[model samples]
Target: MSHFDIFIGEVTGTALLILLGGGVVAGVVLKRSKAHNAGWVAISLGWGFAVMVGAYLSSGVSGAHLNPAVTLGLAIEGGTKWSDVPLYIGSQMLGAMIGALLVWVVYMGQFKAHLTDPEILAAQPEKEGLVDQKAAPAAGPVLGVFSTGPEVRNALQNALTEIVATFVLVISILTQGLNNEGDGLGPLGVLITAFLVVGIGLSLGGPTGYAINPARDLGPRIVHALLPLPNKGGSDWGYAWIPVVAPLIGGALAGGYYNWVFA
Candidate 1:
């Protein structure tokens, strides 16, 4: 495939993917939204549907590798040329960032409300009848909108969880073929991937929110840091490396494993 086609296809596909994916998170997390408090199942389904729609639209052109992990895994598996891998990742990152930005625009009022809501803001340690000015800030609501965090702050466990989930995701992508198209996953494969993402979210997301794709987490996270939102706390940069590095490692591992087992 031509570089231009690949870039545009990936960009469009991933933009749609994250737009809907992040949109669901924003919808449920933000207080002013109708979907508020819809909980995890809705989010999982929404993201799964996001994958389905995005893959269906882009599979013909760029194989719907909306994730950097997927691109790397495919490269390692020889499904994608190594030379095009960078373009795929760059486009996916750009797309994810753009999608996150759009989510902000669509939910601008909700974001502002969620961040500035008196109920949430007053729950901070400083407002909890504590006179200490050094009280810790509350980052949960806003952070949930942008990226993931570990439930227990255990790095080793978090990394292992992401590694295992992404290993399954990337490996499945490597082997799941529906249409026999070169490198491109067919319609059935897209549907299966959507359900697979949901399954991963339900089964493996509890520990670390199942950030199987680096671009999916990091791109929006970068946007969260850059955006001008009220009371938006730290992007939690300390824990950010886990999602990115672990997924890449997992993808590489999956690729190597698949090559060893099936190649």
Candidate 2:
């Protein structure tokens, strides 16, 4: 595929990813939503299916790695070209941002409605009653729209969970690619991998919100900050570094370990 084709694929794939993934978050966290209270199972399956579809759409040209962790891992494994790494990673991040922007727009009406309702805001005691809390106000109309807070210890645990989850993801991708002689992985494999990701998030992600993809977490977090929403605060910039830094470290370790074991 040409460079332009790869760019387009990455953009579309990332948009779909954030659309489904972020959409599910909105559904669950947002109050008065149809899918609210759907539970972790719903989120896991939603993200898993989203990944499967995104992979099917972009895998033909760009290998559909929507996550930077995957891209970094593939580069380390020597499956992807080093020269192309920058473009791929940049495209993936841009795509994610764009996708998140779309979700923000799509849900804007809901946000506005929630903001207009005094009762809705009052219902969230944590944000409503706090006088000078350290954390920022919620991003969207609903409480905890884009804000994720964990205790100090839980934060570390969540970070560790992401590392292990990413490790499994990278190792699985490498193993599957090596075993398959076909031109590309089939849809079933994509679906199964998606399931695994969701399972990781549902089972292990409770602590830190399962930020398996650095770009996935940070990109949307940026959107939450920039987009016009009532009571929007500092975007949780303090903890933002953890997701970006940890995922890369985890992915690198996984890739290096996989290469060492396989070689």
Model 1 over residues 182-259: C-alpha lDDT tens digits? 448878888999999999999999988888999999999999999999888767777889999999999999989988
TM-score of every model?
0.93, 0.87
Count of steric clashes across candidates, in order: 0, 0
> What TM-score does candidate 2 get on C-alpha atoms?
0.87
- Local distance difference test values of all predictions, in order: 0.86, 0.71
Off by over 4 Å in 1: 126-140, 178-182
Write out the backbone clash pairs for model 1: none
lDDT for model 1: 0.86
* Candidate topping TM-score: 1
